[model samples]
Target: MKIYILLVITSFTFGFLEKVVSNPSPRPYKAIFNLGDSLSDTGNFLASGAILFPVIGKPPYGQTFFKRATGRCSDGRLMIDFIAEAYELPYLPPYLALTKDKDIQRGVNFAVAGATALDAKFFIEAGLAKYLWTNNSLSIQLGWFKKLKPSLCTTKQDCDSYFKRSLFLVGEIGGNDYNYAAIAGNITQLQATVPPVVEAITAAINELIAEGARELLVPGNFPIGCSALYLTLFRSENKEDYDDSGCLKTFNGFAEYHNKELKLALETLRKKNPHARILYADYYGAAKRFFHAPGHHGFTNGALRACCGGGGPYNFNISARCGHTGSKACADPSTYANWDGIHLTEAAYRYIAKGLIYGPFSYPPLKISPNKIA
Candidate 1:
């Protein structure tokens, strides 16, 4: 059995606008169509008002940036938000915020917190029926994408130009699919779940490519072993299961397996659609740097504890979720990497985003190809 799950991430692509984050600069894509989970979700989860369940849209969540819950899992702007800001665009609006084309020029975020790469039924079938969230699956998210497609273009030529010039952020998905399984005490089912989840993502890419998407940036899962949520949930005393860093060895390995398989799939997709650009953003590597050296990033508390919550060593509790009353924000979130238990603080996301944008993790070299200064 695979024994563990995936994670959402924070990353940035180096390119365009009135400002350039890197060297010369590539033409900034005008639109950014994002599909994934909470990590990319701007406000979809809380927009739906699932407060008691998913439990966002309140304080602490936006304490660092927006000053109120913007429905983002983090304390501030998500990587998707930073991506738009990097190019001088406003925050990417959520698809659920559909009113008019008021902000469609900059692309729409179809992501939702708790989104799984697989269908909701997969969780139920894998013994997590109670945790199933139907509307947040990738299939449902893609449906939103298809629905939004007609609004972006009228004629074939407009469609082609629009899609070709747009950027697609596919995922850091499938993590929730595995998260439920692991938490449901169904680790034995994890191995069987990986193939279908990967297949689903590959199929999503094929559809996006057929729809005229030429540039895609897919960030992989986070370091599950290092995640306070995972560590707290899968707490173990067995030293053999724990790494020197205190991360669960088996869980981290499972996450890596997912990434390796995803990389291979992206490679195959690249070969099949030679004209399309598919870049794999290494989220694990980015987060690992902080875990291995939190002090360098100004995160003094290391990776074992969160900036909020109370329960175990990780300071996380499944029952007393973040944003609830009595949940105090850390004196300084910048000094800690994890925000609550599941998500990273804005500081952490920013650090990780910078790493992906300036470093080697974002493939095809994010800064080399300039189309036109948008």
Candidate 2:
């Protein structure tokens, strides 16, 4: 009986091992280094105590995944979080939350809520300070990354070796720069801000490349025209201004312009650095899919309306933002695309991430190779 039992156990163990060997796990990234705004922020906003974007830190924000607000400006995880998961890494700890004793090998998030591509000084100098919320702009976040670099690796060779295995996500930034200008109701200012904003993003990317980053995913801005906030703020009676999807044409065009300039800048960078893999993540096209075909994408609540907001045509009320009094979340966030007036729901982010990872969303698509991102 004992001999028979041993034989059965050995057979079972070998079968399991054979199965595991046949189905190899997907390649994993050593670490991820992320930089951006609220769209990608995991918790830097809450950790740094930047401007009191109270809505993000309160309940109903992370309810779908973390079951509590986690400084992410969403009803759940952002695309960054999903991407990390796909690579089999833990959710990145926000840079602000790190202490000297913490492990630096896993990953870190430099994204902050309300961050912009342009420095706060730019808006302040332009007399648009009121429109600005946080000073943790792209440069500020990149500075934080630089400060943490020494701890990550001391020698030049060590740094190069470590960073080559790591993944760097540059943006989904620069939107707030335009958002603030658009809110100020200055069309000229909004149009004027695009070039500098795209330039700033390109500069940041170049900086990252100089610092040993070999693989970088730089995402462009979302379709602000379809956002609940923009829909509310830029509502127009002129039918021509609104697209068939009910998104404002002018703002979407503006976002496309920024993306176009950014892509061109990336092409230049690719030429300059033949050794590096610099890919453009089309956040605009990925998210816009839902708006173009809401029912087809499982967005039963439609794409323009916010799942959590104060009541309005778009369910967003500036006076009563999500997480504040007089605002509430929908019973089912998966049915909706937009989370608050500005950010997307975890469900929406998941779909977008999948599109980037597996198909027509990203240029040259994001691929998982045998040992790293291809």
Candidate 3:
């Protein structure tokens, strides 16, 4: 029966995306600059040598789309990839992989998997030294961008023109800060990190604006309660703790609080930088639709469950994570909302991109100026 359902859902992927790209026309953004964590990471994490023989650089990680691993923490392309496709731009190259001057002319991605909004020093100061895995925080990513700027454009006027034509993606960040806090097993500490995290993101945005960014899309965190890892780690016998969609209410509330604060910060940023278009991408709302109606979205395998991982109710086992031995993948990845336990599948990302591109998901639905489209 499970196999039968999976096959049915696989067929639905083609139909589900028929109208997802209502406006297939391209946008005028000549280049894209992205900053985030695993959700948007194209390849920096793998190229960085952060972990030798990292599981993410193996088979099954990029099996769905690229036909091989590409350092993304999923089965195929991410939301950023779909966004680039919609804009009629090539997939952004990881900054670390740049070898020639022409590499970043189209776009550049500085996002790294497991990156936090706050620096490692902040976590260490907060007594989360044990949780610190990588030092490539948002601040570090900004520094990389700063170093690359001089090479891209020499004069202030040149930079202004170059950046104005580029689209900036600031986040879907700050989640790893919370993730590390969660690993520290301190719910109180986790909640406390919200304010500083938002501030850090705000600071990054301000710096980008100073550097000539005119258009930015800052995304909020997703509903962590609906994630398989959180569901497993925070599982409870208390029925009241779980929401109607089978997600933990407490974790979801945390994500909501973060989103609320982040949105408030973006509101302030818009007021401060009236000249720039600072749009807020409601990743939570875009993703929550799947949990509300999985079947409608062709996620017949359900929303919270992972398409690839070790055995369990959610098909997720931390000890035996996806890309590692003893783990398995679903026959049809397009049928599942999640790919591994942590990241989402290409199908789910397409839906979220659709929401942002043409609908009620973004603050002002992302649209291409008709004249801008060739």
Candidate 4:
């Protein structure tokens, strides 16, 4: 594994608006069920044989972490980890790592590294040796609720009771589908791709709703075009399309479109299941702020390049992994918005998680009606 070092610098306004609001009548969630890709993968890669030790499991990766890798894909805890902590719940356990004792109490994480909204081949390449978790599909994760419940709970009634208290997160999943489309040079394919992806997500949510997921958080896709890997790979002649910060507007446009469609899909789902409490987590907005204004958030370089990238349009040479010879690692990954070409640093995830906890997306004023709590 060759590691390249780069210093990313960004100059834009930053810092999230802070406002104190009346806490709604103690509507706290008991547990968090996470689903998605590398962004949320706590330790599934190691547990599922997708990634070997010494890469993410080594000292540098977890040097700033809890003195051990603990299966997180970053230098420290991920966005979901922070969210779970904020809610005062134990870190969600990987669904694959569920033991007899662990299964009953804490929430389960079905998020796998390289998971996609669609049944694409990238997941297979990402290294899920056995499809034991499910039928190797997002749809199947829902089915596991039924299978795992009986064994996890004392009785069927107890299982049902637990289900109602859980908070379901279905996201960080669709980015792989978009990545596949981008790598294939068929951006137009998203027109067709977006629907099924959104459908699969909706279906997953519906299943959770049926199984008793009342408090749901569905995060939309991040700005794929703004990634350092993507910018280096897909550099455009029109600098106007790209800001001084080096984020591509065209690529971000696609992401915005996907999010719009996802919002609509979620709205429709809400209509179908009015009782299910659903909130859309806006990853794009949070990421954009981080990239545009690095300094305010403690990030210096906004668009120098990724700390972990190889050779490609965006310097992502698939042949070389991060931390390898000739591979690039950013000097102070905390200063750069991107940890790798595709992922955000633990700091970035932390900021995003904070936004989710108190931002407009999570606690919308109109959405929080006084009557609902009363």
Candidate 5:
């Protein structure tokens, strides 16, 4: 895969979207099947009984949107929440939340907060897969998806119809694989890790398509270097290693490199499948843009510092943690871009979701309204 390739795939402006040219038809999406990590997870962590992590599935985690804890990692709704609302479907429930026979006709979320696109063993091999607390890698989530088959659809034809009408939301994943590696101080190993993660994602795409998935959205990672946690972890004495945006060059460079290979792989998938609509959601570009102009979107202070957590310049300390007894929260979370130093603020996720829906980012174009799915 290419290294540090410049991505000129789409042109974007802050808080607004450019026009999208069309091939005249868009899929009439009826439901969503989300499979990623914390960014899109609704309540899987809580249902899994991992609520003890506190940063997720507990108070202050859902302070902004739900006005209380709701298992999401951020202060409010996730990107997928916006996507589900756009389509007029109810919020996609975590697969773990399903209790009875009902209209799952809308689909389920198989995402677990600490999920990695590669298997857990890979991380274990690197001495990095140890779940910081409660855990489920991407493969385990996929296994859960397979087990839900009996409840998701009754007949083969019904299953095909489900996939044809639904959007298979794959990622904002593969990030955890990189995240755990970075946190463990294994930066050099990242280059070798990217391929397997991407391959696992694409293979899952193929598996879903084989089961009748026609439209899919595979989002890339955010600007990891700009996250408050990374800034805290990778801060430097030399200004040269940092970009004008104050993000570390090497970390964001890795993010860009991963997105490049992902784009190329999606292009290959598109060619082989020919008729499948495989869209690469440009999460990195939109996120970096937020850092450039946070106030325009109602964020105050331009602080990448976390709205929760304790100590440190970013107000993020690993030991004290968010949702702990002495940890502090900003007066209003909407003013910040990151929630717990690791995840995004609801305000920021809302902005990025719009760019993905109405964009120069999605291919073959989306016939999307600013607030509604087409």
Candidate 6:
């Protein structure tokens, strides 16, 4: 009887081991496709001359990165770079500058630094004023991708196959719309603004899906009102209602509402396209944590001040600019959460990327032994 029981146990154990070996969880994504704004711009802005000669592209701005300007909006790497590295993929190359020599098998960045979701009029005016990249809208970007592929692949079917195997990142674009609307005093026109922005994003996703993007990641907006630059110019009388961390509750609430609606829209898209795996990258939540716990990251003081700038109020000037001789420099940029008035430092972005990678946003509910690979 004992021998028979031992034989049965051995059989069960061997069967379990076989099953485990035969089916392992799908590994993390091998490549990343980044689409968005200055947050993930890489060197596109500088390479395109959007940053210009006397601006942030000079010394002090890139003092920490490559010991010279690399066109990144921050002191160092962007969030997308960290995400790509985390997934063991090479740094993403700009979609606009894809060369025949470069290996685009990993992924590409469609994120123009000053890109917007809405029409180009607003950004064009802004670009005219600042000499930045005239808005590369999502629609046009998709069209660019379509045109570039035929040259890379032998046939249309081969191009589609490459897209099918690749991941698509579609976001960090809409903020320019909000920034323009706010500057234009069109917040009350959200009825006119929000829907179109969402539609444009949806259209971009559908276009990518049609091209065979099975895995997609979309990021929502951050709290723009909480930034020191915005607050200095537009601080409400109800500042008392703001939390101890100086984040405006009402602004955060608006952000939450936007994210909630976006989540629902993504879910609907998933239902419509059953084969596509759509995930929302929670930029709002990740940013909030950094603002709340700046010290936990690396920022110690002046969380709202720009690292390279000249000014007293926001540590920024539309005229004095970053990397200038007279510009005020922060003692330590890694400790501060905010880089410019509107963006985050490399350290802050690193923390945010880490949160998105290991947090509920990337893989919700902490799936234990979930069968992702069939």
**Top candidate by TM-score:** 2
RMSD of each: 12.2, 4.8, 11.7, 14.1, 11.8, 5.0
Candidate 1 clashing pairs? Answer: 26-370, 27-371
- The global C-alpha lDDT for each of the candidates, from Candidate 1 onward, is 0.80, 0.87, 0.88, 0.68, 0.80, 0.69
Candidate 4 yields a Cα-based lDDT of 0.68
Q: Model 4: runs farther than 4 Å from truth?
A: 1-27, 51-54, 121-135, 154-157, 310-317, 363-374
lDDT score, candidate 4, position 77: 76
**Model 1 spans with C-alpha error above 4 angstroms:** 1-26, 51-54, 367-374
- Give stretches of model 5 more than 4 Å off: 1-27, 131-135, 367-374
lDDT of 1 at 204: 95
- Candidate closer to the true structure by TM-score (higher is better), 2 or 4: 2
- Between prediction 2 and prediction 6, the one with superior TM-score is 2
lDDT of 6 by residue, 270-325 (tens): 89999878878888877776677677656776466677666756677656656656
Candidate 2, residues 282-359: lDDT per residue as tens digits? 989887788989989899999999999999999999999998889989999999999998989988998988877776
Clashes of 4: 24
- Tens digit of lDDT per residue, candidate 5, span 284-325? 888888787777767785647888888788878877778886
Report the error of model 5 at residue 235, Å: 1.2
Model 3 global lDDT (CA atoms, 0 to 1): 0.88
Error of 2 at 188 (Å): 1.7
Q: What is the overall TM-score of model 6 with all chains considered together?
A: 0.82
Runs of candidate 2 exceeding 4 Å displacement: 1-28, 369-374
Better structure of 2 and 6 per lDDT: 2
> Mind sharing the TM-score for model 5?
0.88
What is the lDDT for 163 in model 5? 70
Error of 2 at 133 (Å): 1.7
- Candidate 3 versus the native: TM-score? 0.90
TM-score per candidate, chains pooled: 0.89, 0.91, 0.90, 0.80, 0.88, 0.82
Clashes of each: 2, 0, 0, 24, 0, 4
Candidate 4 accuracy as TM-score? 0.80
Could you tell which candidate, 1 or 5, scores higher by TM-score? 1
